[model samples]
Target: MMVDEPPASARFVVIGGGVHGLSAAWHLAKELTASGENPNVIVLEKSQIGAGASGISGGIVRNFYRSEAMTEVIAESVAIFEDDREGFGFHQVGYLAVVPEVQREDLEAIAEHQCEVGYESELASGDSNCREYLEWLWPDVNSEGVQAVLHEKRSGWADAIGTIRNLARHAREAGVRIFEGVEVIGLGYSGAEVSEVITSGGAIGCEAVIAAPGLWAPAWWQMQGLDPLVTIGEGDSAEQRPLTEYWLAREGDYLLPGVGLAGNAGRAAPVVHFDHTAPLYSDRDGELITDQPWGIYFRMGMTGGSVVGGGLPLEMGPDFELDPYGPENPKQLAGDDLSEFFTSGLAFALKRFRGASDLWDSNPNGGVLALTPDRYPVADWTAPNVYSILDAGHGFKMLAVGREAAREILGSAKSSLLAPFRLSRFGSGATHVVSKSPYPWT
Candidate 1:
């Protein structure tokens, strides 16, 4: 459970201690134990668990996606969260995506695709229908200029820290060795294979390594001398590939009126998303219009009288870097200026938040995600014995990522499910194209 001293070696060394790392470790340990093998797994954390995006995430869980792969993985993850046995801090309230008139067709297509994939998503279109659904759920919401809404009956949000801790506890209970405050500085490569993990605490010899370093993945990949670009494959087959460049996208968040809004909307209120521009106003601030394309999401706050939401913008700027242990990390040292910007931005999207007294808390600390050319996760063997997991800031997919990674690693079953995300796909032209959704990652 707890490691007082770093073991000299391990069968598998997992880097980072956030959601993906803990989930991967727990799943790996569980599988190893079940198969009657000594699960010599070690998790090395530069800091405490949930010290990254997973800890500060808005914790939205939705099975809505344009890609079938994403939809399946998310559905699987939701099942894990709903297991009750895992003790994840999840609330299966539901998720709603509201789109503008211009995006109504896109929303319809996505909704139809979700249903085709067996997700319980409904389409409520037209001004009357959309407004009716909004009023039926949250009466205070402004639904003007809306074309349609995609409501996923099973999606919702969870407590970010609570879910991370729960996953870590499960990993510990399963006999995975977790070392806090231990950092993996470098990987000792034997030819194409990583023979050892050099850490701040000590060197750990391992047969294989899975690096889910969250925002630190870029730095780790650079340290290991692996190209940041992933090769996409031609056609649907990931077997043949061509080299391509990739980048990471930055995701940020801000809170809304939580408990108070929930009380007004009803208990366990559904998660809400907005993709249309609207006239927004506040008693303190003047009229503002929602930005085009980029949308925002909101759900009830863990505590009373507040809601939580954030900006979901596509990547367009220079790559983001982080100093996890220093003030250089935006998540660690959020300035008043950034906080004000997030609040003001959210206000432009939601009219109900105009006169609410100082109810916004932009966790100002944000993180970056590895985005493939298509903005999907890159999960596969990047090198000999080295598996890279690029989550693209998809927090809810933690459980599924760990489960699938362990399944494929143990060789008990070959998961064709993960083939689409393989590194070789980039060069093979087996890349996913951007969806019609306003959000690029979709």
Candidate 2:
């Protein structure tokens, strides 16, 4: 919120005031200050900080992933979040991922890989074992048809907006200038490198730039005359493809208002992953049958009710409405097809969530997530002096990704742990394959 002197020019400029951009600025300024260099760092935001998808994210953090790189980076991210100085309302309640018969083996392999990375996880098999574990952790949960369960002891959720604001505070303390309500309109190119960043306030000369545009990445790429992504032997090899759009899944909250529920107090509910299929019951259409299986995650003690969401991927464009918090936003307060699927499916799965559909705020609301070809983030140098910190949909990992990217930018570290997520991966055929996990961003 405070900009010291407000330098007309800075050495490093970060776009977007979300978690990733602020993290980059904070870490970069910290590294520079520690090295006695004291580089001028600036962060520009289009709207308010965390106004993008990061503000409405479920804020669940975990180290479970089929890709070794993701597993490793997320592990480091947990460490960073756990550090009290970061202070994003971090809790270590742990993450429980339940799987049915089809995903049993895949979940086991993933759990084993996670253990190898020094992340301790408990694996419970059979309905009886899973039911026992679920009851032990969450007494009210209905664990039926759960063939395998993977519990990560160290992973859990955090306060999304709180995390972003805290990171901004840290950045300011480190002498990084953050200007809110300032929109970056364009980027000035100097033949081979990005020389300046054009903004609504004014153009700022910078030596380097890190664009963490979030959902506006497609628009940013198009403005720079480059495509969001280019795949090999897909469509036209020479032509570039638009960045994939993904609608974030959101659900209602369960709240008693004055008195608190058992596991709903102090976020007592641990992060949960429901990989089992549920019977989709609709009031108007009766029991609706669909081929696609249902996968949803929820945890108790949000501002309103228990947060529940996660279904199949829905594709859309970048120009869709983004203000889910507004009173008039239909995506925020309207109960549509997606909301029906989430509420009904949740009611069928969890016994405590029987009447959650009607008790909630009537609508499911979230923001748009910029998706990549491999369904992961890309943290790499795009041009000579321009870098990108785009998180495909895993916006929660921005804390660790920002720290690593700053290390790379400061030349303190060669290639950060996220080297696997470089932009070249799509062209080199080094994409991460999605496992049977309910969340594709994992």
Candidate 3:
């Protein structure tokens, strides 16, 4: 509900109504009510729910990661999405990662870890095996330079806005009050802890605060007098880097009616991601697109009759403004070149999309992301009583982060899963390992 005035006080105040905030609120309300405590949880949103990056997300849910910690966390999240498949609008069409020879070792290690964690997946090693596996799914798959494949049968995509709405419904039913258009202006601090949340409408005293501001995290971090820059590494080799970097991505789909782009078994096609060093050529003019490493992920559109996907993102400067933060905002949208490259890349990967370059949708679908230094998420207590769910660019798929965060907020033991994402990692030089893949978050 859109309330004009917030309560004078609440047990907990959650900022941002996206996936992380709402998920935390929903879980918190359930736990608090079950424990005979007052479920006085309030969720404050600057705009409406699902108005941030969550609304514009590609909604791909996969546990394919080079890091074991990330794989475990995302596996749990995928389970949560599967548990409420209908409610979350999740389509268990599976997830596939096709990579070059250089990533074979990392992909094998990930597959082994997934087995140890009881996550179901199949790994196809070598160029021949990879090509055969991909051919069995889609005969027209262009697996020229592919040397490895990791296919997770349980992972797939979900409807972003639908999932957010369902989460809001759950939170509301559990006695969580959600207010829209109530922007969090600042935080009132008493000594080291936050005493209250000062908003556009009024002030609300709360015991703890969970800030999940998404792309607007830099602004919120600044409001708390926290430095946005951090020192990575140690000793004389140390380097200063922004804690959060802004990135602009272009995502769109091409309408192709009567085109049953399904897998070999007549099932819906799984979400496919291709990372290759093979030079790409334009399907429209046979012109060389690039000889360098590139990656792209695509899936059957939620609305049907369309193929939705996106390519690499363009990084914005440190001074990039995030005031108007939506694809509807002109400045937030990507350029036409991205669309051209994305479509051309799609055709280069699959013969089914041979003429995809001409089927490009005029409407642009893109948004900004606030990425951490290592591209991994930071989900820890940034302040004495404030827990920030800084997801970097991995927010939508990791819905279980909120559930785990709720337990921590309710005075439970710290989660071992979330320990790797602590804010202290950077200062201690314990950042996540980088991958050979072109994608930063891979």
Candidate 4:
């Protein structure tokens, strides 16, 4: 429900109405209800729910990160998504990553760690085996320079908007009052802690504040009088970098009217991700697109057709506007060059995608990602009473963040899963291990 005005005060004030914010509110309310305490939680949304990045996310849920810490967090999130497949709009068709020999070692190591954590996945190595594995799912596979394949049987995608709506419903049902069009301007501090959330509607006194502002996080960080820049490394190698950098990802779908993942029989196919070093050639013209390494991911769209996307992201300045986000912003749309690159890359990977250039539909999805220094996420308490969920573009999939965050906010000990992504990691040089893949968030 969209409340016209927020209460004069709330016990717990959550900023932002995207996946992170709503998830936090829902989980917090659940915890409060379980403890027989009043769930005086209020969610303030500048726009409406799912109006930001969460609305247009690819919704790809996978635990294929090179970082063990991220993998663990994602694994836990996958379990949550699995528990409520219908409510979360999860497909559970699974996720497949096809990579070249250059990433074989890292892929194997990640697979090993995933196994150690009891996450189910399969690894197929060597060009022949990899091709065979891909053929099992996609018979038209034409991957070149591919040497290994990692398939996560439990990972898949969800409906981005639907998930957020469901989350809002759950939160409201748990006694969390959500007020849309209620923009939070700033936070009022009492000594070192945030005493109230100053909003356009009115000031709402609160005991604690959870900031999950998504793309507007940089602005929130500044409003709180915190530095937006930080040191990325330690000692001699340490270098200062902006804590938030924006990148516009090119994403779209192919309108193959009557086709889906043909090789997978009638069952839905897993999300297919390709990271190859092979030269990409246009299926329509045989002209070489690029000989350099590239990455792309695609899967069956919910309504129909194939959703395909992937290319080098276009970097934006720190002061980029956040008002018109996603495809709604013309500047965020995939250009001709990127559209051609992504479509051609898709054609290069699958025979079914041949001539998909003309069928490209770029309006469905595309958005700017607010990335951290290491392109991961930061979920920690920035102040004594302010908990920030800065996901750096990995929000929708990591639903477990809210559950764990709710526990911590209620005075539980620091979460081991979230400790790895603390803001202090930047100064301590405890950043995640960079991957060999071209994609920043591998």
True-vs-predicted CA distance for residue 125, candidate 3, Å: 0.5
Candidate-wise lDDT, in order: 0.70, 0.73, 0.86, 0.84
> How do all models score by TM-score?
0.84, 0.88, 0.96, 0.96
Residue by residue across 1-442, what tens digits does model 1's lDDT show?
7459889999999888888888889999999999899988989988888877677666888865666777777877888888853377778888988888877876777787777767788899999999888777666667778779888987888777789888988899999988888988888888888999999977899999988887676677787886665544545554422122222232344455342445243556688777755543333455343434546566766666455655534342335445453335544444454444345544544556665437655554444444446667767876768777776656544478877887777777766667777766567566665555656556
Residue 343 alpha-carbon offset, candidate 4, angstroms = 2.4
Best by lDDT: 3
Candidate 2, residues 1-442, lDDT tens digits: the string is 6543335689999998888898889989998989898758999887888887788777878766767788888887888887863478886778878888878887788888888888879999888998898777656667887888898988887888788888988999999888877878888888989888888877888899888888777767876778655763333554455555555544444342332223533446667777765555753345674536667676655564445454544555545565443324655432466566665555655666565445444445554576776778888888877888876877675588888888887777666588888877777677786777656566
Worst lDDT run of 10 residues, candidate 3, spans 355-364
By TM-score, the best candidate is 3
Q: After the best TM-score superposition of candidate 4, give how far the Cα of residue 253 lies from its true spot, in angstroms.
A: 1.8
What's every prediction's RMSD, in angstroms?
A: 4.3, 3.5, 1.6, 1.8
Question: On residues 71-108, what C-alpha lDDT tens digit does candidate 3 reach at each position?
Answer: 88988998888888999999999999999988888899
| Model 4: pairs clashing at backbone N, Cα or C within 3 Å | none
Segments of candidate 2 deviating more than 4 angstroms: 1-6, 233-240, 256-267, 282-286, 289-291, 303-313, 317-328, 331-340, 355-363
In order of TM-score, best first, we have 3, 4, 2, 1
